[model samples]
Target: MVAGRRSGGRRADRGWTDDAARAGFLGVRATILPALLALGAAPVPADLLIRGAMVVTGSAAPFTGDVAVRGERIVAVGPRLSMRATRTVDAEGLVLAPGFIDPHTHVEDQLLGTDARARLLERFLMQGVTTAFIGNDGGGEADVRAVLASAAARPVGINYASYTGFGTIRRAVLGDADRAPTPAELAAMKALAARAMCDGALGLSSGLYYAPQRFAKTAEVAAVAAEAGRRGGFYDTHLRDESSYSIGLDSAVEEALAIGRASGAAVHIAHIKALGADVEGRAPNVIARIEAARAKGQRVTADQYPWDASGTSLVVALVPGWAQADGRAAMLARLSEARVKAEMQANLRRRGGAEKLLVTSGPIDVKGRTLAQIAAARRLDPVEAAIAVITREDPAVASFNQSERDIRAFMARPWVMTGSDASTGHPRAFGSFARKYAVYVRERRVLDLAGFVTRSSTLAADTFGLKDRGRIAPGAFADLVLFDPRSYAARATYAEPERTAAGVRMVLVNGRVAVEESRLTGVAAGRALRRMPREGTCPA
Candidate 1:
């Protein structure tokens, strides 16, 4: 049985109902009391205590238990912990679980400017997330420590980690040019990547489908990835393509796999999904290929946002790749030219018209409107309308264009983990995890509670090598979430995108309470998690 001991106090309420008492109360009390005292005396009185709840510890199925937290670590886990604490959370009738980890996000630079950081952390807290991985699709700059230090000085609500963006590096060095790096430049890029890792980057991340990075040859990427591997870091990719765009999906997967094999780095596919209706159910084949790669001893994992349509720049929807190459200024210049506009119209027609495109960011007039509506009102063709709207307002308009079947198919995989792929202004930014449970788990019944938690919590921790976290275990980090499963749901929608999610009762980061009773506590207890030394290595 689990161990514990009685303290001087009456102890936290047992929470056992009259019926459950006969079934477990006495037996649990006998095992818990001494174990609690023993744990409390073992060099630390836990900073927090959560007792009498069902805990999904990430190691096994759910069980009724108590958890004790000392400083930032979970010191004891038993049926009822007796540690004295600065604060105690009553979790009766709640599910105590590992805090959700969003494995893919673009919150890095977004948080650096605007009021996005505070708002984004609020949204993440509402969804019961305690930690988030930013820099997906590889768009974060170096100066990792300085960036984190600045963020820390402000009161953020959740923990954060990041991947250094190869795309951003390419932009910094090459400035959106479509040319391969020279040997000296390549060495400089590698050195920058090494410094990022040393400064606490989780790994190297690349977005080959995006500008600058798209021009990089495989060898160029391999050189940087190899440096990350040598430094005990992992590699994550947004792949060269996901849709039926420049590179086919199969080719993109192969390219990512080849990079992992060549560099000896653990690789992850960021937001593994097939866009468009033409490629639905293609995930099974992709998973099989990933499995085959794993069988050959290549470490690979993937994360997915729980939605069909992805939010992104509108320039991608309307313009062909080569035409949009010069970034915003060049695209604006092209829009000003009558000849360039004519050629752009032809390209839009090739993609079966631009009627399906929608506007979601930038100017006020077009923020929530669609291209078809704008075109009809302006009395111009859809192409002209797209150009006018983008040029006058936002060059970047998010689109909704994924199949529902593809979403379900990908979430069913054992290896697939959860991510919002969202920033402050997006609905998913506030509602992703809650929506996954409310819509997919409760309403649709597509996945059970256990299955959903695994994908969103435990599996994410395992994939990212987050030690002593992602689970309610003895001697693990006290990053925990407590919520009402039946009542939990997301209220945010496209119209009211910044709304907080519903029914998350509490959240703890590193044994400190971050949220309580569905309200933020204004606590900033998170720390930058550096890479752990390898086995047999000297201490830092």
Candidate 2:
């Protein structure tokens, strides 16, 4: 028998293959899709009813209740609502909360083309994410309007937002140069940032650690960030340095705080960590600096992926940005030079020893081995081996530099939220949120269920200005995640990064069930969530 019961007036004919039925076997998603969930209308009849789940309202303890969704908003949420509904999900053993919102993600690979791959953002759904902000680390499209438009043309399974990347804008204005931007160049970058914010960007994002963005100084970043702030958008950044290799972790934290202070924009530090062996136990210092900044009235927050290993290219993890300033050919030439190669190798060793770098994907033969092991097998030193791999395939690496103590310290902070930084070649793409639930909330108890839910959902929504999201309340967007609390755990690992989590019972995006019974319903229910400039809040 079908697990769910159907009772609503808009019931369709048999077969769960159609959009309405496919979205949920319970039979309410079809009517809810176009007719309901708009800005003002509430729909004539209720569309979905979820009963018996422990609802976390983001403001208090979990309560047993019934949640009634109409159109795309939760019209009613209370204990035992005596109302009629089309479909009822018997969520007796489940936990229902606002759908998880990932504020930092690299989902551009899943949005590029009209392929089925582009539309199926199932990995995020399984982890209970209904909305994700992509275009992180300045690797997202420079043409902000075009990227958002393209995603809308071909819908995905989750709501999406993007930030205008300072690196992309800088590269567009001034090729890969190692100098200060002229007044005109700075104006162009600021114009690009301002237009993107006005055109629906949540903020300006920068990876000052990466190439062209690295070339830009702190003052230049402030100028561009200020333009985004003028439109009331935030500044999200991967700081200039996270280790002793350059500016050091403490200064990097200060730099992020300085950006917020100087620009009058809320600053969100992406993937905050004290990276490298040199900064192994300095999370407390970093936390202190952030607290100091916050006390001074700067709106500063940060997001972290729950992992010790961080994913990036070998060139990014090790090679000096100067050698790679012009292009790949310049980098390759730099690698060929003995003096330059030696300097980079010394820096690579200083960054982290070879044993800490695990090859995630690249050449098949070296795919799962650490640089130390691969170097031993290749009959060369670790630095030479890494250079050779980059020369050949430019494989990605999981650089394990962060301390567990630091991770816990950051997680314990109220200002810290969740982000996967989900990318190709990293397990975080599939397992970040789930991993937090399984390990941090359940195993370690560093974060309780209520705190975990709040951190993962509402905090992210509030920080990004996603109106009415991250809460299980009436008039809020019906983006939700339902899962068996006992079984919610991430199965993805570095060795098996493609695996999805377990215990996600159902996921809804704007009142349509995107995932049910651990399966993708093939429902492209997500809508582009734009930061409505005049309103300063996105409409679903």
Best model per lDDT: 2
So what's the TM-score on candidate 2?
0.90
Q: Candidate 2, residues 226-281: lDDT per residue as tens digits?
A: 97776677789998988876787788888888888888788999999988878889
Candidate 1 lDDT by residue in tens digits, 83-193 = 577667778899888889998876665444456346337788778898887776778667666655655445455667777888877777777777788888888888888
Question: Which candidate leads the pack in TM-score?
Answer: 2
Worst 10 residues of 2 by lDDT: 9-18
Model 2 scores what on Cα lDDT? 0.80
- Candidate 2, residue 537: Cα displacement in angstroms equals 16
* CA displacement after TM-score superposition, residue 503 of candidate 1 (Å): 0.8
